[model samples]
Target chain A: MGLVGNVCVVGLGLIGGSVLRAAAGAGHSVWGTTASAADASAAAADGFDVGTDAAAALRRAAERDALVVLAVPLPSVGDVLRLVTEHAPGCRLTDVVSVKEPVAEAVRRFAPSARYVGGHPMAGTSASGWAAGSAGLFADAAWVVAAEDGGDPSVLREVTALALDCGAHVVPATAAEHDAAVARISHLPHVLAAVLAAVGADGGPLALALAAGSFGDGTRVAGSRVELVRAMCEGNRSALLDAVDDALGRLGAARGSLASTGSLGKTLEAGHAGRLALTEQRAAARTPLRIDLTAPDAMAALRALGSRGGRITALDGAVALAETT
Target chain B: MGLVGNVCVVGLGLIGGSVLRAAAGAGHSVWGTTASAADASAAAADGFDVGTDAAAALRRAAERDALVVLAVPLPSVGDVLRLVTEHAPGCRLTDVVSVKEPVAEAVRRFAPSARYVGGHPMAGTSASGWAAGSAGLFADAAWVVAAEDGGDPSVLREVTALALDCGAHVVPATAAEHDAAVARISHLPHVLAAVLAAVGADGGPLALALAAGSFGDGTRVAGSRVELVRAMCEGNRSALLDAVDDALGRLGAARGSLASTGSLGKTLEAGHAGRLALTEQRAAARTPLRIDLTAPDAMAALRALGSRGGRITALDGAVALAETT
Candidate 1:
């Protein structure tokens, strides 16, 4: 296959719909399936190849030897993986779900023979469903492709290619690392936003009225669909619990200092430094590198690159062109 | 006195500079002073009256019976209040500090004879200094005015007019109530943002690379000037401690639920509900009501309106025009 190939996306929600559109837009033959009648009809109305039957789509993917992208929520992962096992077992599989380890486990349980790679594009809006998706949604976004040791390098390359086709740079890490990182950056924020929102609400209308930019920005994600938020957070329960504990410890220390010395200077200063680190890292110049996917230690190289904040911007044949800040 | 009066603003930083510009724009004779020569020079170069000598400005205010608006940070409040006592003692006094109770207490300690009311505009940018200030900074923002019982109605009206002139709706609350409300909304968010930022940073550069809109928004205020953030949070120490305790309780509950039942549905649902309340309240139609500031229970009436999320939009003679959602 060239840099692109046939793409089959299961579950045409925001991420999946966008993946389908972006893949087709990148010159790959793409099609998708959705359980939602409205989403299926909407996708079809948009002149894209879409359907409501997962079994039929998986069968086509099986015959075509296409890369099947699972894009369902955590709760629905098992059901779709069952269909994949029934119709497209042993095919190249990847997913766009938020949590990685859980989905990988599900794939292991339901479709053990499949060549599976896990992925999560770190991009989304508060909106969901087919109509809310866009081909440009993943542009310049970080798409994590799990770099499991002993996994097929060809499948990994294919996953990286798909991510690049969707206009996202690929970050390669193990499923456990990806889950832990997202637990800190994503899931913990949801929980914090929820707690902050509830506390502000408990202060009654006056507190809400006095809320300004900080309050609005901090609690913005709490407005996300409750069920969706709960699913992802709960799916990564272990990692998220660790993150929550770390945050609580810091908060407790801050409280202790405040109650003792009337100073939150230490916590505020550390946070300031952390924010500065983020700003500087983002603004730092990138150094280019390449990893030969066919190399003996390619997976380890890719994992190390991701750990150091490097991203694979393009796949030149089997040579993964990467950059690190 | 007219609705607008002569205004003397101490500390020509973002808030004070903006207040000076706005008051002048509103046809009040406005002048300001700052300890920083840079801010004073910038304000002076803008062709409005400004000086480095706060004592001179306070003396002028004393001569003109001007309203002395103390706009210094919490740390510098005592020094400025001392100046007010020495030069503008017994003059109509108010402040634009972040915390109210501390400033109110400082007033009682340093300038007991001055007719004092505390104010805090719920508006600011991450940037600071005279150059960053704009006359429209507080437009449509909530400006909390401490409505202490036995606080002279005239001083309350003066502060309300200043807030209205600066294009902010006045939220009448007691100093304690204002501090408590802001602890929940402003100070608590700052703490949470700091904690969130630190946690993301702890996940290392990979996590920062994966940080998306949610993480960015949740920790935006963590990028603010460290000393300024520390000052405000530390100034509201007592109330912030309470708010922090409440947050810790909620977070602990979330962690427990996640560990025990592997579910965060209740927390997410409550957050969703809280966010919805904010949206609905902001969008709710307002019913206009007038509070006669000279009435026997006028202060009580104003506090009641504020507690119910009402605001005084304009001052017309002794009748304060207000609206409630």
Candidate 2:
């Protein structure tokens, strides 16, 4: 219940570096760790207190009241949790891994004494490494917090405040819910884009030559780091499998509707409605993010957050934050 | 064949305005047509000779030894072709519609004047309108020329040269090939994106809010002009239906592969190979295009063609061209 005064981030990659920057900018003493001397030295040079040794970094972080965030990949999260529990056993810990059910289960099994919560900072670029990190990267992004059955409310509150400090909106969900939601939103889309890129490959030389902004934009993430996507797919296989099946079923329905002799307008309308809803939700969430502003003027502009009495917290040198009082 | 020193573009929308800019930048005198007086005035102000009436534009175009480029929507292409043949029957004509088979069939049925050739610029953005048009838009894009059975080579050459002048690589495919290729590459992707958006919508607000770069990038084009997509789906129903079925079958295979204790690495490898092939093809084809250097480092960079055998044809302000010898 102590004030969330210090934040510790493990991994020091894009997501970790971003959290470090956002937390540091929010007046917290931020601590970071990496697997190698090279990454630690690189992060330290960027004004973060990162150390070469993970155990040493954890010991330094445990000196103060800190909220430890495991920002590693899904498969590695469990091992990191075990290490943190053995090294800095008293500090509260959470993870920024994308998939949660397995990670939560691992935390429950390995780190019984520590207050461990599962989190996914639903923000990142395809770019990785400390060099690719940005200060305001997590601004206006979603942070999904999955609470286990016996999870500590004080630890969850500290995690919530940390996410909010990084200009993220906090959403509470179960570990299974979090996994299913991300499977529908993130992992399935990556697989679909991967297959889409495959189709363009068949056109031989001309297809790539013929690709314009649409193709490039559509397949932008198809070139994502293969190892990361692989880990994610393997960790959340069942949920992702269900999502793919659901997606195929929807495609089948559209194909059937369009092929029917009935009014094609209904099928098109359904698609239009679905697109509008998705875009509306994205805009609602993205109004606070600092993404590129390259869209044409004809698109919708950001509107004010109405009637919500939540206190708005600001980070220095970050994007806009207007709180409703 | 007479000299095609000038070209008239009817309907100053995305496709038409882009043609005028490309044609003009490629050393052809360009005229434009607009139904509204305001658009005509804007076109004239923008250095194009504008005609308020379609027939008048075609006649004026013929008087100046120009080819008429029809750049209207799919539903209206037939009417414009009929009007062009009735008014300026001697002028060679071409059209830039996305779905070629239906338009080609319509041209055959409505405008049997062998001067009308079916053309499609395989380049575009999610953007539309005159302001969105750029001189370099078509540079290094693909131009598909579908030759009618026993059609005039002179007309085909004019369209091909126009395509080349726009700095596009010319790909000659039958209307059937064009339709099938686009169905697999273009229409199918749109349908899949729409389906993903639908799935995201069904997951409720929290899931939609968690949509990151992958979801946005994958479904970016789904937010494009709904009417345009609808028209494309309706016009190319048969090909699109087959493509949807094919995509569903692919997804089914992936689901099976993942469900079984088989190699997830192979599934990942298939995606990797698909993306790598497309990337390699783009790199090879991009050797002859005047791509901008300001794009993100992750995006396809436009390097000077001097290293290759290709040479810059033009570089004035925003318009740049690299042509292969």
Candidate 3:
């Protein structure tokens, strides 16, 4: 394992913390910042190198030529970018935000030199907080990387490398495409669950009791952190609104079919087709892996090789090799 | 365990076979019939006294002064009623059909002599067929009994006792009420799932693959037995249609709030209220339990108390207790 030299992970929450853990696990000198000293100390206790603040974290991360990963909420991503501009002026940076458009805009406005690539790890649960952090949470998950303005090839490669080190499949797309895809697949389903739960809630107690498996399963996500979903809906209003409308229209059409005694076979066929199509597209290719080898562990491993003055391979990227004798 | 007096369960599929297992387990002389000799033989081997010929099974059931349970589908319930009239003329009868109105009509049109009470056991899974049968399937489930005209009180009590022995809570209501209740709670959810699945299917392959936990859960029942759900839609068309319309209108309201950037908090508040309302309703008083005491186990227990020469203690119309010298 080679320590990642000066890796900066913002927002010390579950996703960011997991990234910190994975980077540390892979021998990366992880630098992390949080909204509070408590979270910073917590990350430090968990083996992350806690910086004085977000700006300090960025500066120290930059001095070490670290990769900065913005892992804040969609709404708070802009503020973090502002801090990045005031601090890490020349560092190659990327984000782990779920929605991409706003972060891309913020990066364009504030941190123009920070090679900003958008990243979304399609992983989560209904629970939140640092206690929910796990190093292997993102394993085998699809890590979507969105490149804006033909963004720095090195930054894209570096983030893709980071994702691979954490055992994720990397998929590249544009910011607009990512937002639209998530709106249709993720945002819409949450709205539908909430709506369905509301409907079943009014069905009377006996009906609810006899709900069996269907209602419970369907309403599971409705019980998710409402504030987080609300933030997503608000931050990505237009996209989510359109998604909701599209979902309702589809539901309306199906209701009409059921009402008219029309063929239900057609309805089921459409669902089957949709599910198969999504599967085929994702099975396109395997993800890539790279690492930084100019770190402590790789240098040590290099020294042990009884070799001199050569580059060592990082699991995520091809960082310049350390001289070994 | 003494065998229950002759019990006829029409239709040896999941629900019917399940009833057969529970009754037979309780020592009832349970007899069941299926569409094919294969099903009957399978049921027979599984401990039910099943016959390939429905007519003969019905006649034998009737000759034993048994309670016959109509366990066929909605579309076939009417034809089975006619068969009941010709073969099981003297048997007291009930049904285990999901919907109630059509069968209520069928019961009125045929099998006039038998004290026919409509029964709906609100228990099942996505699975069907005799192999899916389980003795404890009805445990803690609500068994809805619809009171019909000319249905004897004593027969209703007997059926309630059976529901208890099978580990079900009894809920009494009229056929129309039962139809309306199920339409809203059960049938509406199926339509919603179908609509959801249809949207994903039509959204192209990539869009569908991105459907995660919520979508899968919400649309799980969409892939249910197509014919059965379609028949439910058609047989209880008016109620189901009304429920679908009502659910759509509610969903439209939710969408409108999001579209207009109106109070989402208000819409969510309404949903919260509805859910609480359902929770309160289920905590109310429970319906009484009734079933055939001549069920084998009950009969054995009864005979063990000493056939005819016993000191009678209490007789609560449908049930009685006695002490043997």
> Each model's DockQ?
0.86, 0.30, 0.25
> Candidate 2 clashing pairs?
none
- For all predictions in the order shown, the interface RMSD in Å is 0.7, 4.6, 10.0
* lDDT tens digits, residue span B17-112, model 2: 888888888788888886667666776778777767888888787678678888888878878877877877677878888888887778777777
Better of 1 and 3 by TM-score: 1
Q: Give the poorly placed runs of model 1, Cα more than 4 Å off.
A: A1-4, B1-4
Evaluation by DockQ, superior candidate among 1 and 2 = 1
> lDDT at A285 for candidate 3?
50
Name the docking class for model 2.
Answer: acceptable
lDDT of each: 0.92, 0.69, 0.67
Candidate whose TM-score is highest: 1
User: Lowest lDDT 10-mer window, candidate 1 chain A?
Assistant: A1-10
Highest DockQ: give the candidate number: 1
Which stretches of candidate 2 lie above 4 Å from their native place? Answer: A1-10, A17-66, A83-90, A129-136, A147-150, A262-268, A282-325, B1-12, B17-66, B80-91, B123-140, B147-151, B164-169, B262-264, B285-325
Q: Any idea what lDDT model 2 has?
A: 0.69
What would the per-residue lDDT of candidate 3 be over residues B1-325, giving only the tens digit for each residue? 1224557888988899899889877777777888867778888786667877888878887778888988888778878878888987767889988888888788878767778777888888768888888999998787776554445666766676677667775565567767776776677767667666666554444345345676777777776777767766567777776677777777777677777773355555555455455545445443332333435344333323321112223335545433332
Instruction: List pairs with backbone clashes in candidate 1.
Output: none
